[model samples]
Target chain A: MKSAAIAPGDVTRYGLGLAAPLALVFAVFFIAPLAQLFYLSLHNDAVATVWGLGQYVKFLTDPFSLSVLGATLLLGAEVTLLCLVLGYPIAWLHQRAGHWLQTVIILIVLLPLLTSVVVRTFAWIVILGRQGIINSTLQSLGLISTPLRMLYTQGGLVVALAQVQMPLMVLPLITAIGRIDTNLADASASLGAGHWRTFFRVILPLSMPGIIAGCTLTYAAAITAFITQSLVGGGQMLFMPMYLYQQASTLQNWPFAAAISIIFLVAVLAIVALFSTLGRRARINGDAT
Target chain B: MMIDRRRLLTSALTLGAMHAFPGLSYADARPLVFATFTGSWEEAHKAVLVPAFRKASGDAPVVLDPMLSVDQIAKVNAAKSNPPIDVMLHDPGPALVAIGQDLVEPFPVENSAYYKDLIPEAQDPNGPAPFFQVVGLTYNPDTVKTPPTSWADLWNPDYKGRVGITNLNSTLGTGWLVEVARMHGGSEANVDAGFKALEALKPNLAAVAANPGALATLYQQGQIDISPGNFNAIQILKARGVPVEFVAPKEGAIAFKTTIHIVKNSPNKELAFKLIEAALSPEVQTTLTEPPYLIVPTNAKVAMTGEIAKVLAKDTDELKKKFVFQDWKTINQQRASWIEKFNRDIKI
Candidate 1:
């Protein structure tokens, strides 16, 4: 038998062939169910006997639904911003720390991810409860007369979500910041750029890709986090996931639930697309500089 | 008998496929799958009901697939012809939904030994209720001082920022809402009064818990002092030393029938019937009514004992007198709209 020469095109074809099984699985499992969901969303009623865009119309037309959508999107932004603010310092510290300290920082960053999300959220409940640590501490210190209501509040929810999703933010930032050349920052400093100026000009822009990546991961995770959202945010604080659950599971309104899912998917996709566009622009600007 | 590479690989793939998809190997004689509720219900059924079922059926192969009632409905609805679950347990609201959706088979009531034994409220042709989940005012006794005698106690300004509640996503929440509406002169069909009451309750509300489970957490954390709570849930908390006390208000505690139904087109229909029969039986019900479980029995013959007797009722007569059963058929009709309204209006 003659040995056949392998071309780059052949490698690509072989790669496609290897991906065929997974593609088939996705098509059958994920794509098929998603298609069914979309089809279900088109119906007017709960049973899905008649086909119409009534479900979408009902969601989009209703101010309540739109507000829920807005609140959910805003929640993701809040979480992302908090994660960025808190996580950037830790990621920076990780990069600058000694070998042992770097390992310690990484472990600390990753420790929350290791435990279950439910466990972490429950821990947050304990920490933010009426007679919880903060409340007791404040009361003992005579800081306040009444226990500050923290659990189930939006502010408390954001903080808990930020803590839970910190790893998702920090991991990407660490990798992105690590990718930046140390010599670039040193050269900027040598040129009489102050520490703050060096950071603002060199480090921040260079870390934009990481920031974008971290934000995207965190934003998606925080928004779609059903367990954390429900447990932390409470019932009255209706986020998209909880809203969708209330429709689908509680009311058994499949059509409406499907519509909510589709709308949420589209909204999240749009946000992710925006992030990618920003990342691309940042890259272009970085290259231009 | 030569194991060639292609043949070996093909055989290996076949074995792996069979392992991954066990239904391919045993589609005809799959064990009975009863989709009971998660947590305490799962524990009660596993300990008391399953044993009784096994004993009656001569140790028949059974699987306890614990899930929420709505989930069971969804699962069966998705696969009408070949349902994964043989049996399903539901709260009153989802029971109506399951029946309306045509996802469940009518209980063979005539053949059931305990169907006639069940109290009038528990007996349904569609699905016989094996258990009754009682909802009443639960309070932190240490903090509450005076035991609340009525639902109106929740509105008292004395307990400001110390009350908890769940949204309409749960059976407990919806049932409690209907009861609240009834207290405010609104029936099951109309809960506008309930909404008004909830609005009034905003001041006292410490945490509008996402679910009943979260309410328990609030009590444990001292986040809430008083709330409309499930009897069994409060018992579970009390057992764990949570200092929570359940009291049936003067208006009457809401009794939600925890209905059990055989799924449509279940392969193990006979076993499913046997299992449900076991669930409805007095012996199993009595055991479940005892300590740790504290599940209120629907079978009239089962002697009410322990915490259930003390907290809920002494017997079937008292139970009938004390427990207020709502027309869930009426409630289920506009439940979607009510939930939507709740989502819109309720904000702390």
Candidate 2:
């Protein structure tokens, strides 16, 4: 009935007009690059060979491939865990703080996120270096006479990644936490549930969606991250992307690199899909949207 | 609010960095890009090594993109026509691969006085390429409690978490493998025992460093105890006030050579050779051994060097007895197999 007053074709035209820009962008950046990569992976040197998936097979079977994949997954999981552990408190703090304090806390939370990955990674290098502030301070405090080895370890990589990815976790959880009414906490307190108990029983059940979203986002990012991992992990990290980088550049095996990348993508997608299924089930059980 | 510019400096220095890194440099300024891949090696070249080449030749410089030695040739090969490259400096490993692909034309300016009397390995046996570069260890005298004369000193307990290494896939890894094999236990030919020897020194590892600026900074700060740094890199390190010592191992590092060649499509073809000819000249090569760019010159007669420049003299007469030179012929023939084996063996 209302369709008589409205122009019928306008909806499709407007929807298409809005989507046109994004489609063009997708075609240009995503589709074009993928096609070029596929083309490259098929060729031996400059000339095209039969478009076979030989490159993928080479990368998959190589023993080094497993090490890199394991490393990437380890780093990704470490980053995600750190984000959830650290980011939750900061998100809660922001949600509960007074208006100006919350604004300031939010701004502080966003600062690392705003800075480029390279800048943050460089900062880590400077701070974690043997003569860097941490070592310098510890030495001055008479904590240790020598600078502890900190810069190029797995711990150093964790700190750098966690710092860079914290905001990704915090922002979403804050939004979810903010939506929870104080009435629920008040009600829980009246029923004799303590702060920690209420936090576990009341607040957490409500924030699961944000937690899931944040984990997914940060996990995905950490998996593909090359620049930060390279800088912060300091060649100690045997990451899959780094292996892919070596294959394309040093080994000159584009096909092999492509194959490894395909395997990685498949593995990552499978893991993410599996995680999301578990998250969806949890959401259903918790009665949270 | 009194904003202090000097306070900014104080804060930055306190924070352990002042300005952004001096933008990482490359060799040529022209369209001809040469990725050096060995990060510290590139930093040394751009900062200390290539400057002399530029000054002596007066040719427009090309960007010297530093890379991991293991991967530079692959990336270059990947970008053959739309090559982000025109010239590159590589050791025998990739040079073998490059030759297999016909990536180079015959290097024209090779009949130099120094090249004529090269220590066998410099001349490319399978092809017409000029031998140009060498690799070895550089140490800071202040950092090392006991200075090393051979590869065995690297496995010292004191150096646990002290030493740095370059890209594991490069000649640095291969050279270290070969040297340790010869000195420690294994034969000069097959390095099974050599690879195992390096395993003992694993704990003392600082970082498998690839970035030249990072290595230079570390060396300057005395963070590195014993690390793989090249001759030109050490020269650059010393100039930066890092108290460095050059260690031409009793068994000299298998003197890996980087052949300079002209590209088929290099626009500055005449300019390129003139620059090459100029670079190969005794005077230019002599000049290279001094001041900013402290390379061991390709010229035998030109013995000029800076006060800090360590002349890498081979016990030329005792090559068979002392050194384990890489047979270019053998390496060239088994090139692909060597690379595959290096991968399967090191599994990096």
Candidate 3:
């Protein structure tokens, strides 16, 4: 079964057969539309659009657009950080728990994903509204005379987004943690490292790939999310995707929308690239140790 | 002659790709794609109008794609060569944008019999106006002891922390802004007065709902007691037992005209025109003006009576005297900048 034993023609046939379907899909679905999107981004107008970079220039120089970009990045980063903090423990428990418990926990984590984003957001509104359960309970307890504003705030937005994106973070981290040999943690303990020390020194560094994967997925989802942000944020908290939708659809400024979309895509990619580089460094350092 | 296997495979794949687009295979009898609102609106059409159109047109296949008007405009513009939407039902704001971008074609009003039957205002230069909506003061009678009589009454201190307003994306929002501007001695040309008025009202505002559905939800939850909304939404809520009232503010109401435009370069142009004609027919108009849809008809032939008549303007003169239709083209142009300022300027 050695590769060197196989004929060159057979190897070529096997490779092509294995890759043909995916390569075809990428060509038709991903690469083709992406190329069209880039082309549209460079255009000057909607109908009979001519090739130019005026739309890109306008987006880069506009203060409002710059602020939107900042908000999108900030939301994405906060949500990703929150997801990691909340997801790590659940993922750890998922890995160490009994088989039946693991199944139950995994199902619980995946429950939100089963429901529509719109439904989940509406549920959050019922929980977080002015006269909602939380405020009513607080009022009865004489905690405060007035209802505290929770819904439509940035904090509310982040909380809802983090909850929706939690499962994405946890699943990947679970896979990464599962791949780590339990012996390493045991060995670290036997070698006189405390639980926290062993986790930081061994488990954390080895799970860098999972951390990068989970963070990137969650960050991308939160950043591009429109419905949750629109419904929960009440259109007051502006995000890049919302602005892009307005430009593309409401205003019918296709060139400008295309330009914003391109920039947003690049920004997400840049963040992912940075994490991937860090992941590579962590892997190299772990291997050396 | 050796058969190059790679070359043969490539050719086969390309042919397969070409075959994927079966929609283009038929030159005639393809289902005409018609785009409009979702939920009850779509249901109303399906229950009455679609079947009537089908019977009249010898059972032509029609595909209904339910989408927001903004989305329909975007989809058409994106696919300029062969747009998915053959015809669209949209408000004047989006219709004006569609006309400006050349996404839609001008209606042939001179030749159509239905054109003569429409109220003069409904005969838009861009397209046929199938319906009209009154965007006015909407409130819950159960919550507000004194029903609002004027737009200025929303600024009352008693209504503080209990008011909602539609976001700038909707015609209802823009219509309210125009009225606010006019009331404050500034026209749509100068909306600064409106912004100032809106800023003052922000303390009272509980939510600024982005879409009609969200606004209705806010009303249902009792989060807001007062809002500037349209007759159709109020009718829907009232029918659903929300105990809401649609008041034509004493100052006057702003009319939002709804039009059905045939998309430019549509593959099914002939069928699209028939669908528009069918939608404007007296039978269809009657169905739309009743019960759940509760839309006001632009067809002069379709008479309104009972509660619907009392709320809706009876004639073109009454419409002109009582309701104001803004310069929608100018409004569409200024919408993006206005939205940016509104979002930044107001607290809610």
- Which has the greatest lDDT? 1
Model 2, residue A176: displacement in angstroms? 4.0
lDDT of 3 by residue, B126-195 (tens): 6788878778888989889898999998899998887888777667787788789889997767778899
Per residue, candidate 2 scores C-alpha lDDT tens digits across B298-317 of 44455544542334553334
Candidate 3 docking band: acceptable
Model 1, runs deviating above 4 Å: A1-24, B1-27
Better of 1 and 2 by DockQ: 1
lDDT of 2 by residue, A1-289 (tens): 4676586767778898899999999999998988777666764442346676566665557666676687788788988998899999888888789999999988998888788988887888778877778989999999998788777677888888888878888888989999889899999999999999998878887888888888888888887878777765655456777777766555556666776776787888887887688777876776643
Clashes of each: 0, 21, 1
lDDT tens string, model 3, A1-289?
3566765767787899899999999999999998888888898876525889889888899887888899999999999999999999998998899999999989999999899888888888887787777878899999989877787788888999999888899999999998889999999999999999999889999888899999999999999889888888886677888888877766667778889999999998999899899889988898788
Q: Tell me the lDDT of model 3 at B269.
A: 79
Q: Write the per-residue lDDT of candidate 1 for residues B152-199, one digit (tens) a residue.
A: 999999999998999998888998899899888999999999999999
Residue A224 of model 1 has an lDDT of 96
Q: Output the worst ten-in-a-row residue range by lDDT, candidate 3 chain A.
A: A1-10
Better of 1 and 3 by DockQ: 1
Residue by residue across A99-164, what tens digits does model 1's lDDT show? 999999989988998999999999999999999999999999999999999999999999999999
Worst 10 residues of 2 chain B by lDDT: B20-29
Which scores better on TM-score, 1 or 2?
Answer: 1
> How should the candidates be ordered by TM-score, best one leading?
1, 3, 2
DockQ, all models: 0.70, 0.16, 0.38
